[model samples]
Target: MNKLGRKLSLSISLAVIVIFSISILLTQYFLPKYYLHKTKERLEQVSNEIKKMDKTTFIHSKETIENKYGITIVYEPINSNVDELNEVVFSQLYKKRITLNKFWITEETLQKLAEGKKVNKIYDQGKLKSSFFASFMQRDDMLVLVGNSIVHFSDTAKIVNEFNLYMLLFSIILIIALVWILSKKITTPLKELKDVSKDISELKFETVHIKTNDEIE
Candidate 1:
């Protein structure tokens, strides 16, 4: 009911809101950036190791893009008489629902891959699966298709989303606790003022316990 009490409550609410907003913005920026850098480092490591394999191994063909996520090496050339592995692997990767970028190493794509040139990529978010199919031939007899899954990206996004959700929840709780503690402190001062004012008006100021601290007495 007191003016001091009203002012204190309003100030506390505003400060809490501002602090919470800053927390959300900072976490949103930093957490995702860190996660992306870490993921890129990992994928780069895998891809680089793959490049090494290309140099060392005697090729019946340039190695087909092996499905790296959950699928086992279904048929490495040494074990299988059927080089029909390309067709089978292609069908299975499509079914598993993990496709991000596809480079059909055509004469054009192979040229690009060989030259280490960046291909013009038109990413179709609507049909992400379209990114999965790139056809190639390592040798005349071997058809190599190098493709990736949307799962790698989707998993990254999911993890980042979960992380952001945790940040938001933590910020909310921290702001609430701060506001509660400050609100009580703010009320204590105003309530002191109120009681003092009331006692003065009622002419009981002489016996009033105006000071809260025993140490200050």
Candidate 2:
């Protein structure tokens, strides 16, 4: 490759690297947050749907709702004594037994529930990373809890980076070929001009017929 081809290839390779680096960083930082936000929104929607249903309808459809949404639904009485709240009533669909304390239901969260506000919690400690949505059912006088496992995007980021690596390799090869073609086209005209200058210096007056259509012509 000549000087022009080398320069063009380097510039394009640098631009491609910069672009892919920014894309990878953005995916690493923002993609998981966006997924979490969407998951929270979905949980809030489910909570609202439960709030709209009557007690009998909600109780009868508990299993169906749990299966449909892939979430665990639990309810606890709105007791003033938090310590007395040892166990929360779990839906029949829930296989594992869980205590009220496991849900991270604190005094502040209870207060928020009493004031007609939904509380959201993220459990990131155990092997199962999950998000919980808690809301108060005024009609039934019950605190409704909905829990769903959170999907981590680390694996997704890894897959994307791997795909980008393959694409970068392919792009490098394509850019090299493209740079070679372009440099040949540009230098062909310059080479012809150089030959014409040499001939003129030797007093060989031949008609220079360079038809490059650009200023190089």
Look at candidate 2 and tell me the lDDT of residue 18: 89
On a 0 to 100 scale, what is the lDDT of residue 160 in model 2?
A: 93
What's each prediction's TM-score?
0.42, 0.68
Model 1 off-target regions past 4 Å?
Answer: 1-41, 53-103, 116-147, 151-185, 189-217
Best lDDT goes to which candidate? 2
**Which one is best on TM-score?**
2
Tens-place lDDT per residue, model 1, 1-217, is 3455456556765665676566556555665556445544544444444445543352422233343432212112311333355346545455555443442223454454445542332233444423322222232222333333222344455566577667656666665666666566556756677887898999876543445353322
Give candidate 2 misplaced runs (Cα > 4 Å).
45-108, 129-140, 200-217
Residue 182: error of model 2 in Å?
2.1
Worst 10 residues of 1 by lDDT: 70-79
